[model samples]
Target: MPKPTVKVWMEEGVHSAIFAQQAVVGVFKLPQVTCLCCAIGLPPVHPNVHSTQKGRLLMSSITSTQVVSLSSQAPRPLPFWRRWLRKIEWRLLLLPVIGLLLWQGWVLLAESGYYADFIVPHPDTVWARLQERWADGSLVTHIATTLREALSGLFIASLIATALGYIIARVKIFDYLLTPYLIFLQAIPIIAISPLIIIWFGSGLASKVVIAAMITWFPMMIATIVGIRNVSTNLREMMRANAATHWQIFRHLEIPSAMPELLGGLKIAVTLSVVGAAVGEFVSAREGLGYLVMYGRGISDTPTVVLAVLMLTVVSLVLYSLVAMLETSLLSWRKAGKP
Candidate 1:
């Protein structure tokens, strides 16, 4: 069999035309033919070339070439607005939009004297109060105080929980010993013990930090325990077969397996830490958003109270979002596994 020859005559306005013919003819093996006009740089014979055998072959080859060219070109990009819409997490906006609409309806009802301002203040009044606090710098100071306490408590809690969780998960005796105490601690309401904690540590930063840490600790401990224990048995056996040390097995096998769960626990702890800090402040504090809330309520300043609550909500959301973003960056493998 004779191999088809692909000859190119480099000329203006004809490179694509000849390349297409050569490619299709070689691929489909339709016939051993040449385009004399294309190879020698003459004008196209005819747009419709079905009049003769050679004309039909030339036309088909050119048609196939055009098809290949169209398929190979990069697709046109979407318009900016369409691209932006696709990028948005639209489902996540639903709850907030609904809440906003409900709030507006309540404000409308309040304007009709359905509820007193001191009871359920208008959204505009709350916004004005937020703006006033922001202008005086008190809002920023209160938010900083709360965030400092919350983050400090979370850091300490995470360290302790991780250590305790690992020890309990690895040793059956430790697990048996600690299980009852953990349950007891979780069952007892933090509100019930706040006074005692305030008494022991005083109505200062120490007590608040301890309170926040206590509130954030249990869930993280449980998550870590579950994650470590749930690591694949096959992986552990393989590590053992390789004579891996306890530290090696834990570092290489357990920690990676447990990362997804650990991050999940961290996200929960981040939100709870905000609540813990607020609770601690509520029990005893002269400053912080919780204190602001208490002061506003004592004076019947409903707008101020509303503003403080909104600030706490914002803080919680920001912290949770940070944890979620960190989880995405670190546990990208989990996302990769998804369809």
Candidate 2:
């Protein structure tokens, strides 16, 4: 038997290095032994070690050098304004700025007498009409009335849609029985049936609420059904294994899973609710933004019509924003736990 020996090699100007040695021993059942040799020198080896096979050394060596480059460290932080502008919301402002430039171009063209006041009223004229309505309190009154109707309708529609959607999702019989009528209602334009709604509910707040609800119902219903159905089957099975009741399973396993889709549908429904309220007002109403538009058209007041439209746009945007805020608040856990 002869003592095993290791030879060392090095390159000049290498800052740091590591050397390791591994030995494998025995015939059928070999045990591995590793030794760490520092860069300064190799470790001392045992004097009485032997190999079982001739011309075979049960040894391996690995050498590694640590390289440190100054440029590869941390990067410099961006300037305050540069970092701020990199945000998505800040970048989105470019869209509205572009829109404003296009609108100014249109205003300039109108000022050049390229179009009649009735065709493209001056921005100042529209502003003046809006100011007049605001001063007379009519703008506030009309906006309040329309918002009330829209919100009321959305609340009622959400309740009905969510309940029916859950039932349809859970019960095959209800799905088969009610799906045809739901499709029929959705396919028919609300405007075509709005007159009948007005006739039944009369030209009151009840009719307006009903119209708004009808308009917003289908999207929410579909969203609820999809959301409920998409819940994990494993979770439902686990709940059943625990002997959970149907109500318990629905509350614990289904609703939370369905929230994202439900919120998405609610966003769409909230915006449509505004349109619904306006349509109801168009069919039969005396005091709303829609009525203002109708009355302005009858009197040939283009500025008033523009103002009413701007108010409607504002209302829709506000409602959509509220829904978005609610979604963010309720789904904060999802965002926090995102991969």
Candidate 3:
């Protein structure tokens, strides 16, 4: 029996064609043969031996009909516009596009004083207040304080949660001991025990950082656990069959396989850290964005309150963006997995 031969073809680095050609003549036969390559699963370029240019070229150019043409002269390397189109197909623009549109709508609505009751004030008024606060340096101080606490909390939470998650996923004893308590913590709202946190740690940076950590920990924990546990069983078996040590299995296979989930958890942690910091400041703090908001609300300065809220939102967005950028950098291997 003659073995099958494959001709792999590419056009501008994109998979263009895969041809299966036979070497022996009438001794062996292939029934219902079909070309296996196309750009993103479209119909094969050469279906019949006489239909398209690809088919005509294949049939007329080859004396034996046993030969197959993988592609047509490397396809001219694709035009610039076509390359751009391919890139567009490769990347996702949906979430950012929707977010920008929503942001624009919010700006327009805020300026129009449409939801001017207790929710949001006019955008111009908010902007004016922002400028005034900026000039006085209080806004900058507030933003800095809040961001410091949020980042501190996020760092602590990510470290602890990721470590614990890896432990619980890999160690049955740790999972038994800690999983239920972690779940309980996740279920409990930080707002419900604000008084306790303030009483224990005081209305200082410590309390704020702790609050942020508490809020951010659960999601990271859950994501890490799922990710670590979700490594393909076949891959695990392969590693074990090769007599790989436990550490080797984890370092080589488990960590990389679970990275997507870990990054996902980190992204959630980033947004939650901002919210936690603000909530802590809102409940009990001398300085920070939440304190500004509390101060504005106390005096019925709706515009100032609106400005603080907007600033907090911008902070969350910035943190989330940073996390997303980090995720992309760390998980370049998952580009095909990304939508």
> Candidate 3: minimum summed lDDT over ten consecutive residues — where?
24-33
User: On residues 198-247, what C-alpha lDDT tens digit does candidate 1 reach at each position?
Assistant: 99998878888888899999989988999999999999999999999999
lDDT of 2 by residue, 116-210 (tens): 99978898898899888899999999999999999899999999999999999989999999999999989989998999999999987899999
- What lDDT is obtained when candidate 1 is compared to the true structure? 0.78
Candidate 2 lands at a TM-score of: 0.72
Query: What residue pairs are clashing in model 1?
Result: none
Regions more than 4 Å wrong, model 1: 1-85, 92-100
Alpha carbon deviation, residue 39, candidate 1 (Å): 37
Find the candidate with the highest lDDT and give its number.
1
lDDT of each: 0.78, 0.77, 0.76
The list of candidate 3 runs beyond 4 A from truth reads: 1-120, 337-339
Q: Model 3: how far is 1 from its true place, Å?
A: 40
Ranking by lDDT: 1, 2, 3
Residue-level lDDT of model 3, residues 1-339, one tens digit each, is: 344443333333544343344533222122212323333233343343322323221322222334334455434446779878876743456878887897788778766765754566655667789889999999999999999999999999989988899999889999999888888878887988777898899999999999999999989888989999999999999999999999999899998999889888888888889899998998889999999999999988988887888899999999888888888788887667678
TM-score versus the correct structure, for each prediction: 0.74, 0.72, 0.67
TM-score of 3: 0.67
